[model samples]
Target chain A: MVISRILQKTGFYFLIILVLLFTLFPFVQMLSTSLKHQYDWGNPSLIPQKLNWSSYSELLGFQKKEVKVPESIHRLLNNPKLSAEKRQKILDRFTSTSDVFPFINYFINTLLIAGTAAAISLLFAVFGAYSFSRVRYRGRSGIQRGVLLTYMFGGVLLMVPLYQISVQVGLANTSTGSILTLVVIYVVQTLPVSLYMLGNYFRSIPESLEEAAQIDGCSRFKTIFLIIVPLSLPMLVTVYIYAFMIAWNEYLFASVFLKNFNEFYTLPIGLKSLFVSKNAIWDRIMAASILTALPVVFVFMTFEKHLIGGLTEGGVKE
Target chain B: MVSHPGSLAQQEARFGWKTVAPSLLLIALLIVYPVAYNLYLSFFEVKLSGQNEFVGFNNYIDLLADRAFYDSLTVTVIYVVGSTLGTTLLGLGVASLMNHKFPLRGLVRGLVLLPYIAPLISEVFAWQFIFDPVNGIYNHMTVEVLGISDERVNLIGTPGNALLVVIIFDIWKNFPFAYLMILSRLQSINNDLYEAATLDGANRWQRFWNITLPELRFVVGAIVMLRFIWNINKFDEVFLLAPNVKTLPIYTYFTAFTGTIEQGLAAAIAVVQFLLLIGLIFLYIRRVLKW
Candidate 1:
């Protein structure tokens, strides 16, 4: 029996190692591809021989020969005289044959849109979730179902109208407008699940705690603020991260709404532009993809336990 | 429950409404307006360049007569069913295998969600490379290593096989969600139930059939309904992976943007999809909540 157990353990570890390699290999390739030249391939090593920062400089508009350097970066480089002294040096060292990608604008636009949406959705989910947990209004259950139905078509089905509205209101190319529209959609999409999770966590807390607060003559609002909010901080962080990731990684609506205004493009859109030509902009695409994916991946790995608990809360019945 | 006077209940009701007001208003403006507008536009004979009149039922009649619409409807049904079945079965299989004690179990389970979590656009591009005729790994492995040297099969370009391959890709991308759902439920199963079953001389198969299956019915049903609605409304995977085989959403997109900008007809397709989703959501609630 002991010998069989040892064999089982070895076999299990072997399978796990294989699966991990399967998952990590593509990401390693993506990183390697991002660091090499656009036309360069057939490298035998896992790492690039020459560090290619051209993709970074291009996206960030470091190699734009036509467009003048912005004043902020100019001052940052300690060259306030507006002469061609340091600018030319940096340009000569970095500029390649490829056109600049305007990646800095993309990064700012993405952060503005995704960050605003996350904040708005978090606030809405928290307050809305509290009401669902604490109050017993008529048709509460029906209302929850209604909220979930808003997510029924997901993001793609709503694209037609969202596009028309954004275009009509001149909000199509603006970062603020795109972010607000996304927040509007995501709050509705995430509320049902968020409320359901917060509600379960609320129920798990012993009712006597709330009752004691009530007996102390605390108002319902005060009770929620003082007691319930403190208790649910972990879950709140989990919900916020989940909402942030969804908005951050979203591509379909961002694609349609942003249009040809490359100046207003987000990371996902920017990453796609990397693959436009036939020669394959491997390094730039990989670099942009890695940049877009890193933050969410880090957040997910760090808080995976809480996120999973929130997800599976509704699945396992008592 | 009513410790206060009549005014308190009214005040509490007001508070409830106030709390939910922001969410409700957003939902109304974004969801309700767009849906109602789409439904209304579906009945008209309009184009994107701002030209057309109200021709009631003309768009619907045209859709019914269109042969491509029928083909897409059939393709969508097959795609949804095939993807759903494959995802559910594969998910359940993986979940069951991982349920027992194993080495690096957490890492294995987490790594499986890679397809689901990867950026959709980038992943689709990777898939494009993976299936490319010249440099694709799949073809290289099949022809060179397996000695199958059969003619190079253009999986995504062919007529009958393209849609099938897209569905398989969709299943690959989505089954991890089902795995997570099923695995969570699997973990929550009380070991005491297994112990009691064993004490009563019930074998492993009997215990699983009797205890585990009954416990997982609701979660499984929820997963089915959720995946079904998602798969039906899915546009990107079908559009990017198999651009030729026009599913309903893709048809709608092509009609509005790619073709004559028949906005009204596109709106009609959107309305049909939205209504179908609402109906599915209703059925989901009825089926899953009933238990």
Candidate 2:
């Protein structure tokens, strides 16, 4: 019995290690590859032979000289069948020195878009959730059901019309356009879940606190701002993080809407463009990929408990 | 003046609508309007110049008959089933393992969620590099170290292997979500039931089959349903990892934007997808979530 128990314990640890390696190996590969020189691309070893910062420097625009245009873009530009106007446009769009490795721009764009979207959504969701949870209203249950239904349908289904709408509303291929579209989309996409989570949270807070505030001559909005908001700060942070992650990591919409505008490209789009471009620099691509993922990873590692609690709370309650 | 019903309640309701209107308007414009517009566009042939000609279900008919559509549907079903089942079962297994007392369990638990929480582009690129035919570690291991193959195989370059790679990627990236969900529920399971089962002379497997599986059924069901819905519409990972793994969304995207630029056909595809999703949502709400 003792031998068998020892065998079982060994097997368990082995399995745990195996699982951990599987989960983390990609990240390890990415970090190692990012630190590798161009000559080490085909190296079988996971670690770099000589750690290099050139990839990061070049991608982050710390390198002084402009990198040459990829042969593929030049070939496309030189195609005889292509109209001169289209060629000129392509040259204007992609051949700019700054456009070659706009990593910092993309990072800043992601932060701006995601930060604004998260903050705006939190504001809207809080008010919306408060009404659903605390305020007695007509069509309350019907609207609540509507919110849940909206949550069910995936956003990819909306891409086609959304693209068309973006074009029609002058929201395509510009930084402001992408930011506005993302903010609106994120607000709507996040509001339902945030409302659900925050509504439940608000419902759990004792009504006596609000009643006492009201009795002390506080208005309804004042009661919420003074009492409820302070009490729900943790939940608000959870929701904000969730929203921020969604907007930050969103690739499909950003890819579709911002494909024409290199300056407006977010991190995912920038990283993907690097992959698709001919004469691809693997090290720079890997570095950009790591940089893109670093913020979210840091946030997740730091606030993991709150993040998981918020996610599961939403899931379990639903 | 005669008061109709409760005036105070009426005032509260008015105030509630005022508070909710901004959110309602945003959702209406962004979600509700787009959905309705998509449905409308599905029946018309949309041109690049923003011109539309009423086609009256031809797009849908063509979509049903198209070989590529059928191919995408088959791939979608396989991918969704494979991923949903793989993630949930893996999650259940890992969660069960982690439920036990162990050294460094907290750190391990925290690290396990990295794949799910990491940016999708980063993870997808990492996987792509890992599977690259010439330079990737996967090829290197399979060809040089293991001597399993004489020549390096392009895992993400070919269609069949690309699908397999994508399925594996989905499972790997997403099982953490299932693990987290299941683990949370696992922690709340009453230990007394397990103690009772043990005292009644049941073995570990039997106790798990009876107590644990039954307790986990609802949470597992919910996770499976949610994963299914998400995976059915999953575009980013598949597109980024291997564009050739043309799931429904990828197919719709290429059809609409890249290849044919047939917005109407894409809209039709979206409509069909939306209908299928509605069916799934109904099942999810009624059977799984019981919301």
Number of the top-ranking candidate, with TM-score as the measure: 2
Candidate 1 per-residue C-alpha lDDT over B79-160 given as tens digits, one digit per residue, 9 for 90 to 100: 8889988888877877777897765677777778776666666566656555557645557767766868775567678857
Worst 10 residues of 1 chain B by lDDT: B128-137
Chain A vs. native, model 2, TM-score = 0.86
The lowest-lDDT stretch of 10 consecutive residues in candidate 1 chain A is A309-318
Model 1: fraction of native contacts:
0.29
> lDDT by residue for model 1 over A1-318, one digit each (tens)?
999889977886676566455545566666676677544444424577777887766655666555455667656567566457866776554445345556667777777776666677767766676666667677667777777656565554566666677667776657667656655665555555666667677777676898899899988778878888888888878877766666666666666766556677777766666566553555666666676667677777788888777666641110
Best by lDDT: 2
Q: Kindly report, for each predicted structure in the order presented, the TM-score of its chain A compared with the true chain A.
A: 0.76, 0.86
Error of 1 at A215 (Å): 6.3
Pairs of residues clashing in candidate 1: A34-A283, A59-A103
Regions of model 1 farther than 4 Å from truth: A1-25, A35-98, A166-179, A205-224, A277-279, A314-318, B1-4, B49-52, B150-154, B157-162, B196-206, B240-242, B275-291
TM-score of each: 0.83, 0.92
